[model samples]
Target chain A: MNWIVNNGDLIGQLVVAHLATAIPPIILSFFLSIPIGWFANRFQVSRGILLTVFALLYAIPSLPLFIVLPLIIGTGLRDPINVVIALTIYGIALMARSTADGLASVDPDVRQAATAVGYSARSSFWRVELPLAGPVLLAGIRVVAVSTISLTTVGAVLGIDSLGALFTDGYQRNIPSEILTGIVVTIALALAVDFLIVRIGRLLMPWSRIVGAGGGRSARRQRTAATA
Target chain B: MNFLIQAFAFIFDPKHYGTANGIEVRLGQHLLISFEVLVIAALIAIPVGYLIGHTGRGRAFAIGFSGGVRALPTLGFMILIALGVGIGLGAPIVALVVLAIPSILAGAYSGFEAVDRRTVDSARAMGMNELQIVAKVEVPLGLPLLIGGLRAASLQVIATATLADYVGGGGLGRFIFAGVQTQDYPQMLAGSILVIFLAIASEILFSIIQRLVVPAGVTAGRPKDVRVKSSRSRAALG
Candidate 1:
């Protein structure tokens, strides 16, 4: 108790730093993935290669990625940039898949109708496709958001600032409370962000809500859509 | 680059491969922890998951539970437990098992859920009991997903198990952590390469098992586009 209280200011600073390290990559991936995903979906052959490569990247463990970043980027061991850049790479991999999956979920019939109604290919993507893909995209973002927050805690071992710092501090000092606090705070942050994103998704995709709330066969359909 | 050459050299050097502190022992330790945890997790998760899937109850609970399990930062949990448990094998093994149970549970239940209602009905019409239906119909059908959950759980456990060194448990992670401490980047890279290789190898192994076990009809009927693991992955509520 005294540890968290006495270190409240320190914890606050670490939380801010944690957010700083985690949030940008999500934003960056959200923008970058649109083109990346578009290109992947556009070229069916290349999609396999691109997706495989990113999934491979995703398979690389977090600590090793952190360790490897300095050698690749010429950053010092403690550079916050090391953590940021590594996480950004992960975020991109995650978001790109989501974007591709989201884009693919768009109904071809809908696209044909939009085209028949005088929408250009470019505008049709922005106007018809992107909006419709919002729910799954949001689902993907929620995943990236939660995992990224949790992963930033891993950054502490690399000496980048974050809630993970508390964990490291706790480990070194043998204070379980500090580590407990870090775990609690990080989990709470992730859950809150996930909830907020889901709410936003529900708000944006009111049709899902309408269909879900409707009677008969809708329940099964909703589950299929969810699991799909 | 010279780094890659050096790393490959370090990895292949005979000196790194034999003895208690060597790669062999480390790999064994790593696999041992991963294996034990996976066994433990399967025992717990599979039954609960199978029951839920069979009964068609607790769908919401299963979703939330899986998310909660995955959202836990494994490193944090391991280290926190290590503090109390004094950095022995106890902490890491428990932590890894905890990290593993969700996917297995989700995979098991979802697999059962995926069994067609009519298939079970016909079996019942033929006078087969519930146990017979599960053993004969659902098990055969759900085998692929059950394997998938195992595959997913194993991959996760194996990859993350390398972090065991951080908690003072022995594993392949020793190379990465030790190399970092000594500024031996090549050794660290080599450790990472081994980790990646292990993951890929296991993935291949699981894919083969999935192909072998899944009913021929299931594979022939469906394209490989379903998101059984990732979708059930539940945005992993932090």
Candidate 2:
């Protein structure tokens, strides 16, 4: 109780820091990834190497990268730019994959038909392919957004205030309430973000409902069998 | 040749091994920790996923939650849990469990969902009990996806295990963390190289395991169904 009273301001500061660090990379990732993915889909040669690099970035440990970034750039927590850089690496990787998956899944005949109708290649991509691929692409975006939110907590370790600071403070002080608060808040934030994305996905792509609904039905059948 | 020898020497230096600190670098410890977490996560997630997926309620919720869980930066989760649970292996174990569950659950759910409805209906019409149908039909059908999920989860846990050192749990992470703290470039490089190598080795092993566990027929069987369903849904929408 005493800890919460004393540290309430700190908690607020931490939450603000987390959001600041997380949102930019997530938004930037979408911009960077979509074009790159479209290009990759159009050209087969570059896709493999680009994807491999992204995968490697994804595989690297977050802490080491966090520690290494300051060393590389000679910057400190006073600027959240370093965290943004590290988080963006993940964003690019996730979004790129999502873009590729979305574009690949589009019906080939649709592409042929658009070309037959005399649409330019670029116009066809923007007008035809991209719209059809929206749901899968957004699914990828939802993943990247949620992931970035969670990863932002690590920025707390580097002295940028955020929910992670709450965890660290609670741990250092041995205050269970503070720890619980951080955990609850972090999970709640993640859930809220995910829920919003899903809702938006449904709204933007009503056609996806049938596929989503079928996925649900089949999943239920699996559950009954597994339990039995 | 000199660089290679220097790297090897730095890697093998007894003083750098944390042995003086009573943390021996044993292959067995890594294997044990990785295997235990994988088994426990599978046990919990597979059944739960099967149930949730079978029930037809809130799949997006379950999958999204898992993705959210997976997205939680491992270091952050470890640090938080370490605070609650106190340092040592327990915190890392708990974190790994959380990390492993989502993939296993997603995999199980997707795997069973991918099973042929006609096959399931035929089994049911033939009067097989639910238990028998699941055991004989769904499990076989879902095995490949289930294995793929386990493979993914295993690789993730193994890589993330290095973060356990932050909570004072012994693993390869200790070397990596210590090298960072001390600014020992050679030590850091060596530790990272070893971690990466171990990760790759584990991934290869799991791939082989997946191949052995998931019959080739299952893989061949699924894509057609997935494509058909997706196309049908798209057509219905149009």
Candidate 3:
């Protein structure tokens, strides 16, 4: 308890640092995945290969990745950029898979209609296909967000100020209160971020509500409404 | 003969096999801890997921909640919880529960959502209550999806459980972490191999369960017929 009271500012610093390390990777992953997903969709390459590569990347434990990153970048303990790079590798894998899945799930007839209406491929993707695939893509985004939030902790062990610093400091000193403070703060952050993502998803994909209802009545109503 | 002797010697080494600081490093303990956490997470997650998937409001909540939960890093959560909870295995257990819940819920929800409405209606017309319908109709139909979710969750739990060793909780993670600390590449490789093997074994087991539990009727593509009958009944009811 005394430790937390004495070093409270450090806790805040850690939280900010963790966020700094996490956000960029997530944003970059979103951008990178867009093209990868489009490429996968346009070409008839084996999804099996794509998924396997992604899964392998996802499964590579964070600790080893963090260790490997510094060797490649030649930065020692001073910078958190390598941590971000390592974390982003995982994010790219996830986001790309999600992007591919979302695009694939887009209705074929909708694509056909867009092409029939003289919409170019780029416009159709941006305007029509992307909008319809919003729900699935958002679902993928949610997963990536959660994963990035979690992986940010690994950055702590590398001397980046974040929630993990609290855990490491508390562990090294055997200060239970300091550790507790960090844990509580981290969980709160996770929950808060998750809530925001859900809210955003709901706002972006209002049609999901009707789909959520999941019965013949809702389905029939949706079909009739669409035709009308 | 020299290579064979070295391998045997390494395998039988007391330092490799047992306690350095009064902690057991047996393979069984790791399996036990993982099994306990997986079974408990599944038992809780599957039923909750089923209920949520069956209802509209519940589905919304589950999807949102699960997404939120998945965003949390398991290692960080475990470390944090270990601090508050005062160390030992409890922290990792809680972390695993949190980690496993999202996949299980998502899996179960999707499974129920994908159920053929006609089959559900037939079960309903046959006078099955909600519980019966879920047990006899929804669950059987949703088995494959639910199994897939469980398989994914279990593998994740096993992999993440390696981190449990960080907080004095024993598992295969101890080998990996300790091996890294000492630069013992062989031990790290062995530990990773064991973890991967466990994950693959669990996947095979779940696949078998899925095969056994999914009803032959649903597997035969009877949902189309069931849908027609269900539509007629729903219209009549309306």
- Pairs in clash, predicted candidate 2: A14-A162, A219-B53, A219-B54, A220-B53, A220-B54, A220-B55, A220-B56, A221-B54, A223-B50, A223-B54
User: Model 3 chain A: which ten-residue window has the lowest total lDDT?
Assistant: A219-228
Best by TM-score: 1
For residues B66-156, could you state the per-residue lDDT of candidate 1 as single tens digits?
A: 6776567777888899988888788989988888888898778878877666667789999999899888887788777888889888888
Cand. 1 TM to true fold: 0.91
The per-model lDDT (C-alpha) reads: 0.80, 0.70, 0.69
- Model 1: DockQ vs. true structure: 0.50
TM per prediction: 0.91, 0.78, 0.75
lDDT of 3 by residue, B1-238 (tens): 3322443355456766556532245466677777888788888988888887676347557766765666555665677677678768898888888888778777787677666667777899989999998887788777777777887787777767777788878887676567667765445545655666666677668767767766775664222211112132244465
Error of 1 at A99 (Å): 2.7
Kindly list the per-residue Cα lDDT of model 3 for residues A1-228, writing each as its tens digit: 677778878877788887888878878888888887887767556565666567666665565456445545766533788778877888888888777767776768889999999999999999888777666666676667777877777656545666878777877787767767776777677667767877987797787666857754434433322211
Candidate 2 chain A minimal-lDDT segment of 10 residues: A219-228
- For residues A61-99, write the lDDT of model 2, one tens digit per residue: 665566455556777523578789988988998788778
Give the local distance difference test score of model 3: 0.69
- Candidate No. with top lDDT: 1
Query: In model 3, what is the error at residue A105, expressed in angstroms?
Result: 4.1
